[model samples]
Target: MYHTWMRYFTPSPAHHRLGLVCLGVGLQHGALPAVGPRVLDHHVAVVISAGRGWFRGADGRRRTVTAPALLWLTPGVTHHYAPDPDTGWDEAFVDFTGPATAAYADLGYLDADGPVVALTDTATARTAIGRIARAARQGNPFLEVETAAAVHELLVALRRVRADTGADGHPVLQALARDAFQPLSVIEHAARHGMTPAELRTAVRRGAGCSPKDYLLGIRLGRAKELLVGTELPVAAIARRVGYDDPAYFSRLFARRVGTAPVHFREQQCRSVPGGFTDRIPDPSRPPTIPPSAPADDGRRGGG
Candidate 1:
């Protein structure tokens, strides 16, 4: 016979604005019963950590569900699944919903189009799940907000362990970010990696959830802002430093994307930078997943 432990919650309306409300969480294993050929009104991420099973989606095709796979039971979608009786399966599931789900889906973090996502490892994801379960303890008082925050952590963990990312996260994305400040067109950038523009587009979209053009612009503009506030660099010099030789064009682009001219942005933020600028900024190319292990900032200003 199967065994299971679960908890359910009904958070208040105000908590729903937190962008991810965990409705329920469960851990199960052993011989389990079959689930619906029905639909759900919200989203559930059923992560199978061990054993095997089968899943049938609205597409009317049945596919084998293996260990380290994520089943995306999304809103308005039909799903059906069951574990293999003899082998059984271990699973941890989280049910969540919010307006932010659409944005996450758009960002390539959540996709019901391919309902089953293969994972390379579930250790990290399981840790996040355990955190949710603990936060779900009755009368925790901080329950609503705590569980919701853990749900966001769980999503990031899953993204990290996706089979496509391997052990180093997204190499292509890292490389793209490293070279982002170079003055190059998207086509030219693609050529550097031995990729066609279309191929580069697909890779960036899958890894970063944005177009290559958008990704490079994000990096360039971010560096431009840092330089503006951290140094007495002229707007024209800052423009060239961030890959644009034309200060006029750079100002127009910055205004359109960041809602202000560069000089004004620097003026507004320069004085508010806590300890004020440092002698060197951390390289902006590194992924957020990689932490800076360098020594603490020496608290100097400008490059001397």
Candidate 2:
């Protein structure tokens, strides 16, 4: 026979700071009944602590899911998974949502396309999930806050696991993380790591699934978006903050890459979330605060 326990949570408004919110948590031991090849509205992370199963993703591919693995069920993605009837499994799962969840997927921390991720440290993953479950079960007045913090811990654990297992791609990713905001060209970046430009290109492409230039631009754009929404900075100031010297060129690039003007994007975000801008900017009359100084070049001239 199997044992199962689960809890669903309704997060309060204050729980939104972590950029991720726990909707529910569940723990089960033993066989799982076959679940649908249907879509879900929220993301569910199923961590298998023991035994085995099979997972089918939207692509209709069935992959064996062994213990110490994670099966990610992304929102609107059709998926079906279940433990072997004969062997069963021990599983812990958390349902969650928030802006940062999508960002994680984009950053390759979570695999939205591939459903199963083999974990190097099963105990660590299990412990993190267990903490989330325990917090949910406690039913404290601060349940939302506690669960949210635990969810962040879970994500950090996942990131560390991914990094530990990904040895070959580490240097390129590290370089990008360290210097992406600066004005270093791809060639200069490559040279810093004692690699040729072509070698660097190959490494970045293999690691990030994008060219070095594109990856760097993505970093710049992401920061620009954050600045645009969170602060009342002018277009030029926002551009410079994100490493762009010429505001006009930055505006053009932002429009082309992001599908909207910077001002429009900020306005749209403000409209979507009530008081988002006002909450960030307490006094409308005051000038926007400037970000710390960045490298002056930012490889803008090289256009790499």
Candidate 3:
């Protein structure tokens, strides 16, 4: 015999703009029955924490699904899976859909290419799912938004705990982000890291699924947006702070890539933060305080 419990929601269009909305969350275990050889319209992360199963994707390869595994059911993809009838797997799943999934896919976080991912551990992923499950509680007023936020957390957790990702992320990515705001060209950054430009590109493409230049630009732009909303700094000042010496060039780049001018972005995003701690004075030990009013803003929006 098996047990199952779940909650599902239909978030409003306004909530969907937050970039990810959780459609459902569930827990099942103890000789659970099989699931679809069907195509889905949204994504589902089926995290197996214990026992075992088997999965067959569009390729029709019947792959073994052991404990500590992730089954990614991507939108429009055909999939099938079931826990062993005799010793069913303990599983938690969250179904989600949003524009952000495209970006996450590009960044190598969502791998449709590898539908079954071996996980290093289920701890973090389970914790994230737990957040979703809590938010899914019956009569919870914050159900839609809270569960949506947890879905984002769940994706990050899944990405980090993937057996391939190795301790959260690549050392190269950490170094690149650490030096992102430095005024250095791709070639210069590579040379400093004792690598050729081609080598740097390869490393970044493997870890971040983007070129080194694009990776640093993502970091720089994310910082720029934080400054735009969180501080009273002038556009020129923010530009310079994020490594662009020419203010006009910076504005153009920001507008072109961000789909709005920096000033306009600020106008749309600016808010009176509760604590009035607007200045983002860089402290190595502390994280920059982006206002909590924009709960949807995880700060990685336009960067990648």
Candidate number of the best TM-score = 1
Worst 10 residues of 3 by lDDT: 272-281
lDDT of 3 at 160: 83
Which numbered prediction scores highest in lDDT against the true structure?
1
- List where candidate 1 sits over 4 angstroms from the true fold: 167-169, 272-304
Better of 2 and 3 by lDDT: 3
Residue lDDT tens for model 1, 199-270:
999998988789999999998998898888877779999899888978999999999999999989988884
Per-model TM values vs. the true structure: 0.86, 0.61, 0.70
In model 1, the Cα lDDT at residue 115 comes to 92
- Ten-residue region with minimum lDDT total, candidate 2: 271-280
The Cα local distance difference test for each model comes to 0.89, 0.80, 0.88
Better of 1 and 2 by TM-score: 1
lDDT of 3 by residue, 110-178 (tens): 889999999989998889889888887678888888988888888888888888667748888888888
